[model samples]
Target chain A: MQTTQRPAVSEAVAKSRKKRELIKNVVAYSFIAPNFVGFAVFTLVPMVMAVALAFLSWDGSTNNPITFVGIQNFIDLFQDAKFRQALINTVAYAVITVPLTMAASLGLAILLNQQIRARNFFRTMMFFPYVASMVAVTAVWNMLFNPAMGPVNMILSGLGVENLPRWSVDNNWFICMGTVILFSIWKFMGYYMIIYLAGLQGVNPDLYEAAALDGASPWQRFWYVTLPQLRPTTFFVTVMLTIQCFKVYDIFLMITNFGPGGKTRVLVGNIYEAAFTSRKFGYSSAIAMVLFVLVLIVTLVQFRGEKSMNE
Target chain B: MKEKSGITGGRIAVYVILILLSVLTIIPFAWMLSASLKLNKDVFAWPMEWIPSNPQWANYINIWTKIPLLKYIGNTAILTVVVTLLQLLTSSFAAYAFAKLRFWGRNLLFLGYIATIAMPWQVYMVPQFMMMSGMGLNDKLIAMVCLQAFSAFGVFLMKQFYDGIPDELCEAARIDGLSEYGIWAKIMLPLSKPSLATLTIFTFVNTWNDFLGPLLYLHTDSKKTLQLGLRMFIGQYSAEYGLIMAASVVALIPVLIVFLALQKYFVQGIASSGLKG
Candidate 1:
């Protein structure tokens, strides 16, 4: 009877412990429920809908039923000339802006890292553009890019340069892309510079001191020591800048409005015009799918790079 | 003496280059200010007026009266504040679960959240609009707020901070018979103030300056945000450079104030996020 009673007591204790564990799980899940639910409803569900919508035709109206068109949306998108232009423009923008911004920011970071007067002030001023409203900054750039009476052209002609391109309004695609890239580099470099500055803080100072003690010139020290030390930061900045450049929309919208005849259209801008202007929800989703693939590839590459670095 | 002179030359060169770059960076802003104070005709004057001979303070007043600038600003402020607070609440709660909780499928859920961080909004714009409209949330401020409130990036950021904290603290609180909610509210929230501040600034700025979200969701002029309002103002009054610049300046003031007040946190937030610009 005593042995049976002992077994019953142990069983009760084990059962209570299991109940407590279940209760703890409930509490933990309850804490996550609100946010996770919202995320699922808003983001996750919509993402799934986007992928599905790419294969279906919908005019984005309540009356029109979503029709399954299979691969026709993507097939049409591939053949569209404007989509091709947007693809090229987006790639061009990324190709030009990412490296330029990276180089400029890294340069500024190195300069700021030096023993300089009013370093914080310089850093803040450089970063001011990043925090400013894009609408406002692009509006100002619009005025600056004014062909006839703009300061840019005025300064260029003052330097005795003849036949200046109309900057943002230039019919040439490269010129239009260049204007957008210039604005991007100006706006984004400061933020990257701050990242590089933080990266610089992590680099062991003793290495630099040792390089100097080895009679290494400043340039050699920078090339041999600083560059290798900053490889991780450089990689991170490159990936981020590439991703942002692909999504470039607002500046082109405000500055060039696709440049004379839709010359400066980008992937995001194309999606916006397709969905909002044309009201072709299916077609826009197809374009978005292309963008999604591009970004996913870049992100995957970054993750693989990070994993290797960690190893 | 030669080495000291060489150092002085290098220092001078650095100062010169930095100052030159700073001036170049500031040129557009300075031109905006000057143009905001000039008359419409004088705004595009040749040689570009670095200073307005006669300042037109009335452009600011005109922006207010010509359009619903104040109302747009109010809408933006309300949306920004609400969205920022909601993101902080949701993100911190979700982050706590991801960081401290020992539950089934925890790592899997976190990985799902991380996967979405790189997914651009363009991918879901059309579908999200449809979903919002289906839920009768289109053209509503609540739509924008709800859409932005749950950010994977925000969760990831706060989780990184939370992970740095020792689990022993939470265990100790649990041993004291405190509930998980109690531990979160009492122990977690108090310790993660810096991360909270960083997310607050980031969400506020992003929401405030957001153009595409407002453009898609808020169709009515009355519900328009500052960025959308500024865009509309530019569309209607592109030729009126003075008034446009004045409106842009007015729109920029709040962001500048927030940035100036919390510049440190902004930098920290970006650095910690590792990918945010």
Candidate 2:
């Protein structure tokens, strides 16, 4: 009778297996190595350099040397009128954009969550603008707001309203701000609507059905059942909106460029102008440093908020 | 029954309101097209001519004359395709490693990659420009392609996709004596076809529409992207409105075509990225 013997994995065989595992690891690291090298050179090195440069003063021209001035940049920034204006504008933008974007997106999300007809078509239609080139979208806005031969003025004329405000009129600060706010909201609402839709999809359907059978009205169901379920999504969206609003530059650049005496100038635009245009690299780095800290703090708070929510 | 009817009425009201909101979103693009169809004299009419009083289909003809849009299209297309292709090659390799190949400091290294996306380009603007200038890459298309190819988000995006795949597939391939590279090529890649399509479309659109990077890096007017080229089309004369709008319409078409084709995955892809803002 021939006995069936299980062949053992020999010592040489085990070493070969181990060598193959080692080779797999080496291959993995080599693939990841290039990205890490790039990130370190670009992201990490620059980040440290920015923080260090914030304490120094340099004209940013190739000829100049950086003069070490501890805390003076930050101190001078508080008293600087442009800095003050930028801070106010940034904060005001956050206030206007954050709440309104959330409310609009939420309202749209709830509207979309319903048993509606041709929903995906409407969803796509809304999202297309967000995806449209800034050049194209801004041009449309520019033409629409143009005082002469523009549709906005034409619509006003039809209603017989004389001297209607040109939305992005030069040197009119509030009007320019109003224009920025309107454009931002229009561009964003669709993107957020999708997020809300995703959040809506995640909510337990049976919860709504049970509430309905219990004689809960649609509004009641949304307010209690839907809103509670969506709180995390709302929090997530709010954090994202804050980051994006703070980083507003593309639209500002494409539009009047914070025109009418730098009234609409945002922090990112300010950083660009300071470093690239005016050759004030130290000060620009200073501004960037401050902006980075603000972002860090806000993001940390969001993490904390999420942690608490999970708890 | 009256209360129930009222509730139903409210739901209808919500849908109507949402639909109206969606229309307002599209109305601006519609007006742009409509205005582009008008004659030079008719474009700026006070009553905001809904349909051009005198339809000049020649506005489309005039785009070629006003600026070299076809060259811009060629430039943007060539740059976007190169960037997308390079990004796919690099990102997929790294993503495969992160997903299937467990090595030392794997988690730490992946964390390092995600952290790169948080740093805005403005932070790197001057240094990157300086680096490109030093390399004598100024006024060159390759600089634009390279800048976009060294993408942090692409790696992160592809990793998330690779993670969705089952590890058992790779393990089974391993037991059959297939190499790690073989498993990635044969199994993981085929499973993530939809995701790669999503990434391709997203990366293509971003590289195409991006004006700031090209505006900064691309010194020569000839090397400019479509969006930048569209800006060059604007003349001091308001009479150029027809031509300008026509150019804008031209720029919008390729993106719209892409959107129409991949939109199902596009919307879901964006939402899945946890970057809704």
Candidate 3:
């Protein structure tokens, strides 16, 4: 709104309004100060520093002075075999886990959406793994997947399977990566299932009735009505899962710890290993920059997709 | 009659499949519990003893003795409570400003929060660790508390809920000469209970389960949380599967109780805000 200083009385009213606006601003800032201050210190500053640190050389020690080495870390990172492998592993884990989690969660949501007995019980049970601590959850799975003596192999042997793939102990990358992906799917699918259940509920029942009236079968109704209605939810889930998969460290740490020769090491695990274990702050920040850019691109795409959908 | 009977059969079949899937979902945790009770050798006995003839009640006792499990739990509890309480207060307070108050740069500031929420902490954890270490907060539980005390996601979640609140309520409260803080405290806070519960659950669960934060910040044995403690226990006593499972069970009970008690909030919160811990 444009303020016109037409005359003395009008000028006085505008001045008072401006004063009120100032008071409001002060009050708002007072409310926001506490969280914003902590946020700025802990999260915002570190984020900026991370970007800056990526272009510098620092061993994260007091003796070594930080030096500007623009793009050198990136050059070194690209040529590093461990970084390359971690990048591939991270991408592979995300690529495999995201779609599978989405599908399984969607299917589970559809199943639970039916007017069945003890719906909440089933929902709670499914979502239980997500709430459980990753350390505990992975510990249990480690025992279950313990190749030489775990129940998984024991059951497999009982089912007339001669060759067990030696679950986590196997040197094969596929076995390790596959187990990680499967665990990822199980742990996360329930959370997505809840989101999808919400989406499924928002779907108009009238659409199903209309489809049925038009001679559509159950699968057809689901394919034609349910899937389309869930596009936004699915989009949200995919973006969340993608972002999550990239940051997956706890599961890998507990289950594999980049072991069996770093076959299952992820981007975050690499960043951790580099920064903490190797004390290569600059190189690690460079790796972090790659993660940041990947997530930023996904987020930008999400915003764009959301805007288009809203339009 | 035929169609009706077929519908019954279909319903029964769906029920059966759901029951089976539920069992499949629970098998791992059930196995954990079962293994926690069993002797290590019997835990993986052929055909898998679903129930041990004699439960190893001693393994549970050994966990507390072998490692400082109680201290880890105490550390985790303190951190979780403090972080959750602080997050709720600050995030809700900040959210009220973002949602209800008209101010310069309000939209831009809220956008900052949204942007950070999308950026995973892994991207900046190294710098964060460096900053904390530079401040002489290394190997301190206070560092983890400070790091997690403020959250963009919590603010975003609360703001979304607050945005739904009728402006007229605040206006009426203002007419009654209630200060903005009073309006937030007496009105907004009370009204945003569901969101508060949601944030509490997320913060509590996340803090309790957090591994990397403790792994990075809290290096001392005395300050380690349950996740770090359990991991260390595993590394040290890799052969003692029974004790490990027992400790894992102890670690899981708090979260399981929290989840089961207030699970509706989990679904409602996620459905409304689409945020997760």
Task: Estimate the TM-score of every prediction.
Answer: 0.97, 0.92, 0.97
Evaluating just chain A, the predictions reach TM-scores of 0.96, 0.89, 0.95
Please, what are the lDDT tens digits per residue for candidate 3 over residues A197-237? 98888899999889989999878998999999988998999
Over B174-210, each residue of candidate 1 has an lDDT whose tens digit, in order, gives 8999988899899999999888888988898899999
The C-alpha lDDT values of all candidates are 0.89, 0.79, 0.90
Top-down DockQ ranking: 3, 1, 2
Pitting candidate 1 against candidate 3, the one with the higher DockQ is 3
Worst 10 residues of 1 chain B by lDDT: B268-277
Better of 2 and 3 by TM-score: 3
Clashes of each: 0, 0, 0
Interface RMSD of each: 1.6, 2.3, 1.6
- Give all candidate RMSDs, comma-separated: 1.6, 4.1, 2.7
Q: Which stretches in model 1 have alpha-carbon errors above 4 Å?
A: A2-7, B275-277
* lDDT (10s digit) by residue, model 1, range A45-153: 9999989989999897779898999999999997999999999989988988898999999999999999888998999999999989999999999888888888788
For model 1 the local lDDT of residue B238 reads 82
Candidate with more favorable, higher lDDT: 1 or 2? 1
Model 3 per-residue lDDT at A294: 88
